[model samples]
Target chain A: MLVFHTALMRPPVIDNLQYAKFSPRIFEEMRAGGVDAVHVTVAYHESFREMVLNLEQWNRWFEDHPDLIFRGTCAEDVLRAQQSGRTAIFFGFQNPSPIEDDIGLVEICHQLGVRFMQLTYNNQSLLATGCYEAEDTGLTRMGREVVAEMNRVGMVVDMSHSAERSTLEAIEHSTRPIAITHANPAWWHEALRNKSDTVLRALTEAGGMLGFSIYPHHLRGGSACTLDAFCAMIGEAAQRYGARHLGLGSDLCQDQPDSVVEWMRVGRWTKRIDYGEGSAAAPGFPPMPTWFAGNRDFGVIRQGLLAQGLSEAEVDGLMGGNWHRFYAESFGPA
Target chain B: MLVFHTALMRPPVIDNLQYAKFSPRIFEEMRAGGVDAVHVTVAYHESFREMVLNLEQWNRWFEDHPDLIFRGTCAEDVLRAQQSGRTAIFFGFQNPSPIEDDIGLVEICHQLGVRFMQLTYNNQSLLATGCYEAEDTGLTRMGREVVAEMNRVGMVVDMSHSAERSTLEAIEHSTRPIAITHANPAWWHEALRNKSDTVLRALTEAGGMLGFSIYPHHLRGGSACTLDAFCAMIGEAAQRYGARHLGLGSDLCQDQPDSVVEWMRVGRWTKRIDYGEGSAAAPGFPPMPTWFAGNRDFGVIRQGLLAQGLSEAEVDGLMGGNWHRFYAESFGPA
Candidate 1:
């Protein structure tokens, strides 16, 4: 049985809209949770040099934790790591900030095993505007060039945090497929982070994939979220976008601090939505737990799928098979 | 029966790109050309206030030449002016530099009866990057918002000097369609001002229109161009893009001083392409001719179409019907 955890987070730089902290223990927790691999992001509000330095740090960390963190550049690598009883860490970036204004950097990052790059974080960058931006200007001229370069270099352009126009423009401009590495549906949440039906259809029509997120702030009702509630959200998305194109992008900000949250709140990083500030934090959701707490464990997520009466095959697809297929198609052979 | 001269240009600003000195006689020349209505572009490289001032000057000019220069805003106005034996002067700006960074100014300009605005000139602005820019970053964040606002305010978004990405992004993002306004396809000549075939197709698909430019430098073999040669370029474009979406946008720079050309050559207002130290000029082209000489005479262009063996309807479409449809759809009523 190919059992893989689709949405696992190895936090240190993962900054949720509300909080940011570093938790080194999450990797161990993921292992205990039966997680085989996780897509780990590198770029986030960092300069080009800082991104390179962080990539170096990640490379060194993989070397230090050979049994724990095996770098997975492709689906085959993930399978191989799982077979060897090691956790596969696929390199990704939540934002294209590291690439900055130079489009050629996309090819460099792709060559360096950075397989997934979200077009924006929570705001506008040189490439694309994030969902939080008051306007979704789609792809910049450099952004269109970046999409072409990514296609040529085989890097996956992620649109988890992108504006609607940016997403549509990217879909139209890209010769290769794309992915929404983590997002919810606006039909359920009406949040900026949620994908609209038009956008979702456009993504799938372009042979892309979607990673339904588990962030509480993007849920319909503020916080008070349980694993079952998260599964219900995924169920609704699955019905609309189909389970085949759906996977989990747990958006788990494992270990981040309060200062990072402040940085996200105020900064000219991207324009803000007109719906008032600090709406990013779910009203009743407690501060993010150290790891997956309460009924938030992966097993609980599986149980929730059972509660939905989904078949074993469907469950398998949502859990990891779909993501594996997506990675293989997008990233090519190991 | 409803004949309109679609490619007519007002005399003053034309001198800037034409390298000919501005003179009062230029307006008489335009009237003698049988141009019933001319798109009078305000200054290209002027500040917002300067553009406003130019408009004021043109308004006064119309007041002075009551029988010759009538203010034209809609197709009906053009017809009315034509019936009254007057040259309808449709006020437009080659670039939105006059709007500066404020989105509200789009409405302000529209209210002031300015109909057309290219997002950028020969450089990057708050809205978009121009074709001449070394790095065509396309529409900036502000550019996307501006497009929506333009759609809302019923203003035409022209991409005459826009970067390829910016052009495509504008076409995709615009709700009420858009126009190339003035550009040649790179297929005819690999000039910076020429759009790619992909771009042309994208614009047509979005129900937008293309305004084929007859600037000699942008045509193959430059200054050696004749009406027949220019028509051949249009014929090829018409074959690919269909005549319904094609209209003439002769970039006739009639009465401009040599200093403006020098400024354009140095890219003083915009950055130069990377391969070249200076702005990309029309290759192998001689110095820009005086206004009427730079463009084929409307009558000669019609003769050229007939000589090219085009049907009467095709010639009519190329001459003005296409442009009439575009204006009617874009500007609405009169």
Candidate 2:
């Protein structure tokens, strides 16, 4: 009875944290915070060959840090990580670059354990319009096929950095539920990267998941956002949209230097620096909110949500249970 | 006056022949045939880097056979070749493999002297559906952008191997004239690779070009097709669609080994042999019509067209004059 109770009590906590400044300390932090799984960004602007090199680096990390982390290719891996008291890391691409122009690579990427792939990343891509493109052309010819292939192979279609029309079309076109693995509601933050209420509503209605972002640029008050305010926003979101579709994707960039942010925003595609949602005068990583700074800070968010009047179950879901459920369903062949 | 008359008599001829088993013998035959220009294919299923190696090989050929051939990037190159008593070899692609998924590579291909590109070849591609696919999904989202980019960069959109809907859409979408670089009209042969009269009419009406194919698979009677029969079909095509849109594309696979034919038809897309528009039992290059066995046979076709009641000027246009005019107009930025 005690064994069963302990198993029930240790339900997996997952974060779809888009990108993190990777180091052994970060894995330590994840373990400290009880993070069972995280969908880590493996490709932002990488070509297929470059992405393979990244996979090599990650393989080394898994070998070197076996106690703190393991590569998660499916929901079972998350459960295993929880059982072992370690964090499971799943690969994801913020752009479709790693697949390039070939539809065959979609299956190859799934074989490589890329669990989530955003159709675009802050600029018009071969697949769809990015959030920053002047005009949205929606899902491109290649984009439609790639989405179908991704769906078939069980790679979750992520539209976290895509424009509204493209994201909406992806949702309509994809057979499986898509994800905006990291972003908040535009109504709450008014950031260009944030989703509109229409997108959020349609997304949840279509069985898709939305991972509420904690990036400073996407917050209501940048780095100064209060824990109470952030929890209140999630509470209101739960009221407007069902709590089942809500989860936290903290989007932590802990211990990262400035240049890494530049690479994340403008990889090889541009000779000029594109600060994205941030201004050029301050094109570095913005200061994370004091209330929620790293993996360890997820507890603070859970406590604040409970204080903000969310039920304990609802708080649990927001912290990671929702994502744990989504990961279970999304990370396999449809 | 006699010298001027001699110069006028040697009118330049061009063929969008795709890939001929390129050799010095073929170049000599081209000179014998009075063929001033040929759009030689640089890629079938090759990526950009592999295509670059092909360019390197062609460069070696040009350097070794300078008296016989020169590179052609514009219509003027044809006239220059005519004056120099050499054949002008213009680069083309039978498939969009060289560009891969990067739209930026379109301009790079043009800069490398690629003047023509087919959207697909015997299968569905990133850009459009090939004729062999069960369901033709027309111009893909990427296809539209690629066509626009091709137009802006002055690359002729060839729809020889693409499906009907995709071909029609490409013609409609492309601002400049597109081409059915090689294939007979369906009214002439009814081959799966042949264009329908509807496609032909739409193509010519939109100021697009059609190149009469001499490849046996695309001919009415295969290798047994007679010169008079072939010429008669062109005469009928001229009556229905204006003579201005007609030119020679030959679809010639001269002097190629059977394995090379397999490469052209199957590429790297499939591991299994795909006898495109040919019987699997005889999955090799079909015999060339006895009357049109090599590049040196163009004059026989010209004479046969004249015998079938086309005027000297119409015969001239059919042989190469039309393509020369098209080359002049279409090979520069729109």
Candidate 3:
């Protein structure tokens, strides 16, 4: 019983990427890759005020590079980007720090053009416990209210770094479906950050989304992960959770210096170093797989999916179609 | 023991007023009143972004009216204002909307110099229930976390407009002493907005502060309430809660148009007019008592308190000494 805009009727290619060392060169790469819209991480450890500074910085980039990119707030905005041959940057927060402690800010952030927000970034947040936390406390008292507020405001509740219990509770508690914006299935990668079969089933059954990550740490073979293997994993996940619920989230930290990762992992929460997905020895971004090193490498994923025994329609969904539909349906007040 | 700066060694006059149609005239009035610092409401129904815009507007005010006003971030800022003969404008939120739903924003807001934030503003917020709500849900899962975060960040958890249960819970939960920045005792006025003796007992027992309101609706006889009667109420409150836990929060709406009250009462939440406190027939700013009409009237309250059997120290405390001590202690990380 839902109808989408004519702009969204066009075939849309979307990627829900986390963050990178954003620049005009990266915008060029997105355009070259034919990526219509990207859910770009705008905040990690930044507080509400710091996030505003980040938004201000992004505003400058948007003003300065109008030809390369435009700010995307809704599904139609993505189509607008495609039509104009520009990459659409959909703002998101890897953690809910930007909203701070007020539920009223959910709608406020949505009004500011942020389309997605993850409840936690790898620790026990006010809303939900992160995957790295020892015990998953599920949705806290504030989390339920926040999820409802987020649902009402059209801000996506992403559980990319959230624990299993918390993720499941968020999906159950939210009036609208939630999203695992960037994570692989644990069945494939076995990383702590990866989703389990139970999570995927619950997610897809409730009309949620799971954007597969191409981050080497979440890949089966790290930097040497094969396109064929990755595509096959997607095919298997689609067979289980359905193609409509899956898309590319490629947790790309492209061109970012290793030092920035420290902010991502430890932030100001601790004085000591925490390597997160990487070991203390390296504690830096692992080299991306050779086949999917950058934006231009998306085509390799497209071809690999085709060769991995998926129908063309399913392949289209895996690549971007599913995400576009999800966007049209998801990014609005319920 | 904390060592305050020599500037803070001077006697200070403070008021935690909600909002006024701020301008040069009001700042001049504050200077005329010899007001040292004021906790001004920067947000009520504003979202994170909207609040930022509000802060931006305040930033302009501070810049343009340097002689009249300056931004107050720390307790020391009040001292600076006193030394400079300017009113230090300390930022606060009547509602927690500025922080939204992210706990990290509490610290971020502190970083931005928000010294006080109420848990609710006459409605059920994510953190706690406001005074006007039919049902009061105590601190939600997120509320407790936010309280802790606010405590850690030095943002005072104000329960001025929060419901009783929520207010009591906030006072109980916060590691730092909370504040009822503006409200009369229910036993004196019997208004829905006023606090009960039980709340006051718990508040002061926990070392929290209670600022007396001069808002007409919260008065015993509305706008006609006498300064003698008001001073008597403060005298009673001082007897019960101790003089150290009492200060003046006049809740002045000086120079504001009637339309702005509508925004405070019905901020984007309701399409219909909610003549809160005032009836539909006369939904506007009530005439303030003749004895306390503007910033200059603070002296009258000081004189009235002295006449009402309060010692010089207690009168000074009621005027602003308590708030100055509170600012020194509460406006820093616990």
Candidate 4:
């Protein structure tokens, strides 16, 4: 009974957001944390060729650490990772830069194992407006074409870092469910990047999943936020949008220096400086909450959720069961 | 008065096929021939980067001899070339290799000013089967997608080197008019490279154009073929498919070595030699007819067409006016 429970009862543990400075140490940490699969951002402000170079780097990592990590293409890969005692690294793009203005690249990115692509990062893109943009234009012509293509090719259209109108339009226009792969509700903590209740309501109503982000800027108390408080917020969100539409996407930029943050904030778009989410004084990666620091700390969130009076089935769904179902349905042609 | 008649009354003279050993002398010959435009092959079996390098070479040529030739994107460029006394050079690919397996590069190639692309060179491709294949599988799945993309982005689909079934399918599948940019009708000359009546009818019925080839192998009497014989065939073709659907594509290979023919026939697809159009006994370019030996010899074809009793307007259309109209319609979004 103990063996069956350990092997079969535990659900696939998936993290739908990560852009870590990946190394052997992270692979070991992922294994230690029982991570079945992780959606990792492999492109920020890179061209198609540059993004391909990044994929080459990941290919080298996969080859070097086959025992710890391998590439994930579908939901079954998550179950495979669990049975094989390894983690499946799924690729994504934080911005549409990799595709550059070509709608056809949407399918090519899907072919390259990229399961999620955010239409915008933090400003206006060829596709859609980002969260930091002052004016929100829903979806550009190319953005609508790309959304339809992403649906056809089974790539999830992620609006995590997009503006409100654009995100709402994406949810309405996409034939398949689009994801806000890593974002918190603005009701939980007011942040420019946090989504509003209207957007969240439309997202879940469209069968889309909203992965709760533990990024400090999105938390109510920044880096000082506790696991209990985080779990309590998740429980409340579950009530608002139902437990089936919720999952964890810890936007952990682990082991990255401050320079990486600058790249993420202002990727080749500007020259001087546009400090995003951070000011000139504190223009760096914010301190991660002590309770949920890195890949190894997911256990504390699971325990905190249990303490917050959520049923075991609901906890399991949040801990990755829901994502597993989504991956199965969303990673193939419509 | 004669100068104005020579300049304004004459329509644009275009050769939609030429893989010449392009040099300053060739550009000078293009000017000498009163050729307003020529669609030149820029890729055979090149990868995307290799094709870009080839484009870089063309850019250098364009910069070096702006007086002799300029790049053309649409139909008006032909008129512009006639006014400027310069030939308009348009680029095309004899094979889909430049796009490799990525459909996204279809739009990228259009962005780079490639106006035409063939689905196959002389072998099976990811898109469609070539003439040399024993079984013509018609358009593959990627072929359908690429045809739609090519139609959307204004890249003319040229099926000169493809099999009959594939050509017919492309004519049926494409929303826009496709082209047989070079090759004669099999009814006149029984060459494997020539189009059958079924394919030609479908193509022209769908508003496509057929640019007649003057290559010796595709002629009724090979190297000994006469200008009168060629013009008579054109007259017959006009009777069958209307004069507006016919044009000239010379299929000229002036000053090209036999080795270039080898590359075209066997572009890294195999290890063994595929003599293609030439066997072990005769593995070199057959002599071009004396009446049309070089680009400067368009006068003879005109005289022959007039002798064949085609009206001036019909002769004008066959010369280049038809292609100019096709270009105006084909090289932009449908």
Candidate 5:
């Protein structure tokens, strides 16, 4: 049977206070986690140019570390990466800022090996509204046009951070299946990051894929989430929307410091990164549980899945099979 | 019963020479023709700016000679012009050159009271393919976007000068009904200015209106066309797509000179104007037919319709009822 790990994050804490510093030990932990592939985002930076530069740097790093890093543009690449015993790193854009106002830039980025593109991150852009926006107006005039263009160009629109109205409009406008690459079920958690059950059902009915994120804040147990509990959450989603439609997306932020965490909390770059005592803790869930233990790694989570009742097949499907299938259906011939 | 002529062109030639020179005789003939409203184009010879200036000049001219000309932007305007015993002159553009690349300019022209705007004018533009273009690639990316925008903003998209592909694409993209506004039947005479029967059927199916033109070049007989011949052509189209879908677009060039005719034929402007020939011709029809002795004006055409076995209801539908309905559906209260 094909064995793949679905959600594996290199760093466990992204919006933490100590985001400025890099940790080489985190990379080693990811390698030991046996994660076949991972979706890495390089978009939500200061500007489009900066995002390009950061992606170029990531590309070079992947090139240097042949054993640890491999770029995956599609499902085939992920499969090949697993066969070759290398971690497939799929490039993603958390927001449409990199595209700016040009609709043609979508094709350009697809050519540049950025596989998954989200219309909006955590704010409104030219394309669509983000989840954080209070007014969830449907797609703008330009936004509808952009959706058609994206469909024509064969790009998978990720609605992980999109506003409700904009998300529904995208779901309606898209001819191909859309993906919520990393989100929780609002039915269970009631978090803004979680999707309502109605929206979730509609998404699956429209031939879309859902990625249940293992973020403690969105789960019933916040930082105290264990591998078994996370698996149970995913299993519930699988039962709700067939196992074929479900996948894992561990929104792990490992190396980031308290400053980065604070920056994310304020929701803008100019604002100070907040890492206060109680503020850092997620509601319901304990303070961000380090991956599985004190270590911010995927190996612990992999072992934790084994500790649960998940068979190897179910674990593999949860790990990456569903994501692989989704990628293949979305981006043809790649 | 309400009666109006569907098409009336101030003959293109008198005694086999281009009617480049304007004569007072033509104005007298128009008065005799009982023409209540004429779709007059100003973009053919001048740039967009020049077209605006020319229309302003004409507006002032109409103000000075209240008995001769009346500005008509709507069905009510036409009705008022007729009730007031003046010839209602509806301003139109044969080509979209005046607005150039700025889409916002469309709204400006709308504000300035341009009632009809064609996508192309016998040549390719930023928005669409013209009939004369070697390849009719349909609406360009911007063109498709513009069509949707036009529909949303409520601009009548005239396709008289547009290529077949561009016309079809516009029809599909526009949620509101489109108007050919001026063209003969390619089936009657396979002229580029004429539309194919398939396109006509599609237009009618979409609740769009077709405004047949009286340009003799598009007719089989060319300069030999008489008032009876024009009615016969209209009768054939009425048979093909019932009387309700048909309307009159006189394409009447009552005052343009021979130099303007030659400039239009060459598809370029001389030192007298800054634009091309395509813009000079009225949208949806061939160059204006030269004046002739036996040819009657708009009023005579109305009488001719009576002689063509059309009942009062059918004649009214063909003359102006259809246009009134189209304008109401397209512009709403405006």
Candidate 6:
């Protein structure tokens, strides 16, 4: 199928982060949306072995559907995937649990083609404090060694679900630029996972990229967020941090059951329920904003960004060019 | 490093099987030997998780030593490596211990880039009878299903350590040509692991390949075997089974200590020692024949095969071309 781009010439549309209940329908939706690449979450709280089982499942998908998607290992694959009209699926971990306590697994995961790894998920981890924790102690001693190892091996250190202090510490300590792949600016939405203005400034100053989140919980108006409003937030971020440092992450958790959310929230960390971001009244994946229900909505997001007064080049960068450049820099030996 | 070959043009000198204690020096030796590819043993008696750890170690090797070696997943990688002057490392298992009881892991291991798996190492497994078993009941119930699964995923069923009944059953039952990747003809060595004329006839008739082993235990005169005598044995077997079915495995356990051999022999199967092909007096890996101590000796073996009256074309195929073709057919979805 020839994918037509709304912008005459095609720009690689890369979602810097997503954790959907992926299927054929999702893959087709990616094609329909002209999504050139996706940084997919393959692990959250699973051990190294369980994460490998997840990799096996993805491998099956790669084998079963070669026409639609292929494993993405480097930044050049995005352009290759763009030219070939297929999505390049890059693996990532949403938490450090996949590496367990061993630092050697940092290189192992990278060799297995994992390009992104979050330092923490939603609680105090061995490496750093998660956003859900009350106190943020920042990067642990092992965390320093791990960051250096990740830098040496080309695995990007993601601070998406981590605490503010840890995120700042990582940004300051990392020899190379780090990423907050999916998080809104705290100035736009005061969610716990949202980045502070200080972090956004530090991240952009260090040449880091920030992908705007579309998970309803990260939105100011939640499920009721308008495309104009969301695009407007990105437009605002672009003004603060250069447009080259902004892109769509859209933490889309499409078609997931409430139990998955429970796993993400609890994950054997507590016996008592700790509803993270969600409340007892509504402890499930919140509905995505009406403007962005699925991957097929990226074209409209581009249109919305253009309507928000950003130039075509700037909007193209926001769509995927920036992440493509970041991916090229982030996923290889330093 | 422009690798020149003895055949005037390189024919991708491939060791169809080997299990060296690998390092940069060994990889350099393979390049020196004009070896294009190797089917390397990554597991003997490890569970699925442990095998993954082994994968992690190899992954590290691929990362640390890109100039000398690369991970090979397809037959074309052999040609690619030949041109690039590096050895393509194809993964295999000498035992089905890596898959455990999960049939799904057959495809999982294949997806993880494992191209071959032996049903049994040296004992009765859930899948088939080992050579040392008292009763050779052939393929188990799970064995049939696993064989079909392996056939579907393109993982070759290696029967180098399997009993005659099981080996025969596997050859008859499998749709694709199976391999005894590192065993000698019993007519020459009379070792327990060597193939009989009946089994060799069945295997060759079905287009299967038999890799001549160079382990001292598998050689006719042990470590003292002359290259002329060994090549003459292969030349004789060439008349019996055709040169297309013959290649080298060179079960070279170079630079390894006795403990590694003990691990290979025991591997948590029994509290008591299982000497395997060795006695209490010589309870370790035997010395390799001086003619084939490491990968650097492959060129001389080629010369020896040529001197022993194999046509250059036949010697080329016996070296790696035939195995390369076999790899093309054996490592993709059927």
For each candidate in turn, the TM-score is 0.45, 0.52, 0.54, 0.56, 0.45, 0.90
DockQ of 4: 0.02
Q: Write the per-residue lDDT of candidate 4 for residues B180-272, one digit (tens) a residue.
A: 999999999998999999988899999999999999999999999988899999999999999999999888999999998888888788899
Better of 1 and 3 by TM-score: 3
Each model's Cα RMSD: 20.2, 22.5, 19.5, 17.4, 19.2, 3.5
Clashing residue pairs in all predictions, respectively, total 16, 2, 8, 0, 43, 0
Which stretches of model 2 miss by more than 4 angstroms? A1-7, B1-334
Q: How many clashes show up in model 1?
A: 16
Q: Which consecutive 10 residues in model 5 chain A have the weakest lDDT in total? A: A11-20
Which pairs of residues have clashing backbones in candidate 2?
A141-B141, A141-B142
Model 5, span B1-334: residue lDDT tens: 2233345422111110112122335434545555556566667535654565565565545645767666666666655655565556666677777776756556445544666678887878888998877899998887877676667556788898788988888888888888888787898878888999988988888888888766566666765677777788888888998888887765545456555655564545334542322344442224444433322444555677889999877887676667766665775322
lDDT of 6 by residue, A1-334 (tens): 2233536547789998989999989999999999999999999889987898888888778878989999899888887788788899999999999889888788777867899999999788889999988899999999988998999989999999999999999999899999999999999989998999999999999989898999988998899989988889998998988899999899989888999999988888789887889999999999888788899999999999999999999998999989988887888789
Q: Write the residue-wise lDDT of candidate 2 on A168-264 in tens digits.
A: 9999999988899889999999988999999999899998999988899999989999889888999999999888899988788788889898898
Strongest candidate by DockQ: 6
Model with the higher lDDT, candidate 3 or 6: 6
Lowest summed lDDT window (length 10), candidate 3 chain B: B1-10
Residue B72: error of model 3 in Å? 31
Better of 2 and 3 by TM-score: 3
Alpha-carbon runs more than 4 Å astray in model 1: A1-24, A264-291, A294-296, B1-334
Candidates by TM-score, descending order: 6, 4, 3, 2, 1, 5
At residue B232, candidate 1 shows an lDDT of: 82
Q: Summarize candidate 5's per-residue lDDT along A190-304 as a digit string, tens digits.
A: 7777898877887888888887676566676677766677766676777788766767666665555544554444445446444321243531223456554322355555466
